[model samples]
Target chain A: MARFGMVIDTKKCVGCQDCVIACKTENKVPEGHDRDWIVTESHGKFPDILMEIRTERCNHCSNTPCVSCCPTGASHIHDVGGVVLVNHDLCIGCKACVESCPYDARFIHPDGYADKCTFCIHRVEKGLKPACVEVCPTYCMHFGDLDDPNSEVSKLLQSRKYHVNLPEAGTQPNIFYLI
Target chain B: MHEIFTTRNNPYVDPIMAMWEWQIPVYLFLGGMVAGMMIIAGYFLFSGRHKESNCACFSIPFTSLILLSLGMFALFLDLAHKPYVWRLYTTFQLKSPMSWGAWILILVYPALIANILIRPSQWMINRVPKLSEIAGKIQQHHILIRNIGILNMLFGLMLGAYTGVLLSTLGSRPLWNTSLLWVLFLVSGLSAAAAYVHLVAKNKAESELLAKADNGFLVVELFVFVMMFLGLLSSAKPHIEAANLLLNGAYAPIFWVFVIGMGIVIPLIIQLLAVNHKVKHTPIAPIMVIVGGLILRFVIVSAGQYSHWFNAHFH
Candidate 1:
């Protein structure tokens, strides 16, 4: 099966939080609850310093701990595209999967359901990009199937040395960052 | 002291803000205990000689089921929206321990009810003269159900440990991430169950039963307590720092008074004195131990969450 992944070019990214607002509006995500955030890395001493910002969301791991630990089989990767999605109907809101997630990507919604980025599965079904991807002014986030050699994401991975978050976790996150 | 609580200047965050409160912890503690106790209760009901069986085997399941249901309700009440809470079951994720816990409860409830129903019926047949003959015959058919009780007990233990594992899985939460978390939880669960049993029976445990269950439970709890603290001491910087916040920070008083003094020291001393005096068993010792166990749960849940590591990025 083809695996969908994204390569985020942090060098080209501005950390404008457009992705955050765009995702919220598209998904109707609750206020005070964020599905994505910009992590600002600051360096240097005294007056001279530099700040680098990276936007983070679910990395859509291949070996997801959340799916492994879910007792009721509520957390699973979509067979068609390997997107992680929660089966709200089967979930008991025990928050085990939330606790197990390494990225802190998921949260308990006001309705007590676990919610996170689904890689915009609904939009993907319609052959459209995720809301964040559609809204990125810089076009820093690139999404495509990794299986096809000619795919954009596949091409980026072939050409650039990128970093994946928390590599030690061995989740094999599909999201690659062009650091 | 009041200034620390009122002002945002203190880097610490009250546990109430971070997650559940005293009531919820109490509820969790009770729910786990009931789960463990029911399993133990079910085990004894089937294996041991009927006449030799003590009140404990029967009472544990009966009381535990009642408390388990009650604790489940208390948890719901703690939530902001009790009515829509059913949505939680549907919003499942394997990565979320809360989701795992929800399913555990779902499985445990039916097992608990089955054990509760089976034991009494068996007891009635054994005790009531008129029904004794048919009851004995029917009891033979209950082998499958009895085996289910054994399975349930083992499942309950897993559920109980999952509670601690759930918290420990949060790598950023230093205090909870210790390897000792599972042991601490198991010991606490057993102790809490023993304590509830002690309290319910008015601490009137027979010497043999106390020797097997209560005395052993308290001693094991003490061992776990020592190991937990020692483990915290030996851990890396983040965990050690988190431990210090409990021993020396704003939560020290509660830790010392309720958790250590009342919960462990006093109860240990009483149990020791009883053992030394050759009393064989004493209600006072177990009663104190029970109270101590409950207080320990309250303190650990509260103290562990009393402070937060100030965000390094923010500072």
Candidate 2:
């Protein structure tokens, strides 16, 4: 029942990639594979340009196409927190979920199964935040149960104007970016 | 209030999914060809074209079993956890195309076996003496044979459509998101199967008929490809760019040269010529069709990976 989510404050982000590094280390995401990454876009003419930087990872949408396409139920929503997780043991490495992810979030781990940002469910279960959130130098990343009105992530959404990536995708992503 | 920037450019360039290699496409191509072959064999049985039916049936069961095994082997190679492959059959997920495909594939073998049982081959009889008695008993009941044929056709159609559906269901890849993909794949499979049958068929009339049928499938496949392109072109910006990847981007040469030219157009023209008696019916055209069909799977699978939602939004 707890819809866990993240609210990323792009305005406060410096794009230091601390979150990316933290995620990689915390998850032991294998060499050359990323659980999280930085995305930056430069806008306007060079003289008056503005650069927007944000970290990216799995959106963990409510309607996850990855789960729907996975043959063996390898990819499924965690019963407790609505978190999208992959059961590596059951994975056929078909890459169906990898391709179905609109965010380009999921990757085939070198060890050979579809993998992505787990929202650090292990840490969450232990009352700890995701590694990226905990490591954000700018405090731009917020994580908590969005369904809980008292949760920081919920409060952040209530106060800030935010957008989700690829709205046309219709995944209803849980990751919200506060502009 | 300031205007927020919305530009289609991501400064970072990361590789997308590369786990699916040549094995995946090879499996898809083989699975599709087998499905098409079964469908053709079933049709022959239903129409009481016993000679043609026997020709297709004699080969289909064994060919399907071998090819399906090879395809499954390719799939097994792609699996990260080979030991866990059996978990796929534990339960069926209605929403999952893969689950459907797995179950459908399981059903395919039974239908194919039934087709063979209805008309046991001399080789099969020699190998398994009991098969002769079973074939005799089954042959006495015409309705049972017709029912098996229908089952084969249904399973074949599902298998053929499942190949494209497997890719098309991936919402992230714009190139594979078209509704027309399944149709294109089905037609291409039929064309490939027909061509294969034409090559192996001993009867002159059956081979000629299959050649003609393949031409029709080719023409429909061409149309489906066009519709797929135009459908993507008319969609959102990302979809249009995805279409461009095949139309005029990095994949242009392969798409046009290999998939379109070698796969559809050339094969279509050669078949037309052969059917019209302008050229002798050599194995050249049929071989091209089969090659083209294989290449089609490669192009679609690889190119679909190349066409990404993220890439479309940025550069």
Candidate 3:
């Protein structure tokens, strides 16, 4: 009955990539695969440069293209809390989901199935924050129930200036970046 | 030639959805071959020219098998996991064009092959009246094959159009979302199919039949091109931008040099000149027309994909 979400304050993010390392280690993710990571978008050259470092994950979209594209129903919204999860057993690894995804979030794993961040459902079920959220020394990452009015995530949603990546995609991402 | 494209940023990411590097060419080749064979088969069936029809009978089956088989294989290659691709057939959705295509290939391919083999078996059985039972069986097969041929033709029509429909279905991708997309695909498919059959006929034996096929194909191809160009012009902003890319942007050289210049204008001019002069020396024009048609498919498939992806990313 809960809708879990994350809020990362970009101003506080130092682009240290601690969240990326924590995710990789916790998930046992292979090298060259970052479940959630930062991209530094730099405008202007040399002395006049302005860099916007964006941290991103699967977005746990409300209407996911990846889910629509998965022919075998390997990828689905988890029943418990609506987290996007890929069942490796059911996956045919056709890569249709990969192609249809506009955000470039999902990837074909070394095991030949679509893989993305699961919002650390295993940890959340155990009543702990995701590894990425725990390791963020800047306290940039915040995770709580979006539906619960008194929850931190809900309070931030009510008060903060935030943005979601590729909102035009109409996925209504759960991850909100407070710029 | 290589220098021009070297410094060019690929812009294609790990999941190459739209750069359309090789998939477009493969699609063009397959669609052209299928359409070419279909047109030839239809012509032979309708013409009732039994004796000379042997050329078409042999070539149609052979070409159909090669094109469709190769096409399906190319499609598998396009997949990230080629091994489990059979699941596509088992787990199918009627609403999705891709699922429809998978079903189309599954039903039509074996049917086409069986039909092609029947002609030779019938010929063999006729030589020996002692094999009357065998001949009867062959006759039954011939009937079945004929029925299958009908199915293949229907599938070919869908196969021709599905390429466009598949791309157009992505409504978010503005460049490909057009009502005209399906029509363009069908037209291109038919044109390409005609050329392929004509070429095959020429290779088998130099005959007036080949010339006739060439002439019919040229006329149909020209008509389709006109419709496709008009559709391109009348489409929404995304398709219009896609058209502009073909006419003026990065793909302009390929479009102008290969598709428009060689594929359309040159072939049209050749066909016209040959017709006006009543010259038997103008067989080269028909061949050129076929080549042009193939090139046109290549250009459109490639350009349509590139523009569609480019627009999506930028948006």
The most accurate candidate by DockQ is 2
Tens digits of lDDT, candidate 2, A1-179: 99999999989998887888888789997776677877776656758776667788889899899999888888999987899999988887777787788777777776667788899999999999999999998999999898999999999999989888887888999999888
lDDT of 2 by residue, B124-145 (tens): 7899999989988988888887
Tell me how far the alpha carbon of residue B288 in candidate 2 is from the true structure, in angstroms, after superposition: 0.8
Q: In terms of TM-score, how similar is model 2 to the real structure?
A: 0.93
Q: Rank the candidates by lDDT, best first.
A: 2, 1, 3
Better of 1 and 2 by DockQ: 2
True contacts kept of 3: 0.15
Index of the highest-TM-score prediction:
2
Interface RMSD of each: 8.9, 6.3, 7.7
lDDT of each: 0.67, 0.83, 0.64
Query: Candidate 3: what is its chain A TM-score?
Result: 0.93
Every model's DockQ, to 2 decimals? 0.13, 0.46, 0.25
User: After TM-score superposition, what is the CA distance of residue B4 in candidate 1 from its true location, in Å?
Assistant: 24
TM-score-best of 1 and 2: 2
* Tens digits of lDDT, candidate 3, A63-99: 8766765666677889867898998867766555655
Q: Extract clashing residue pairs from model 2.
A: none
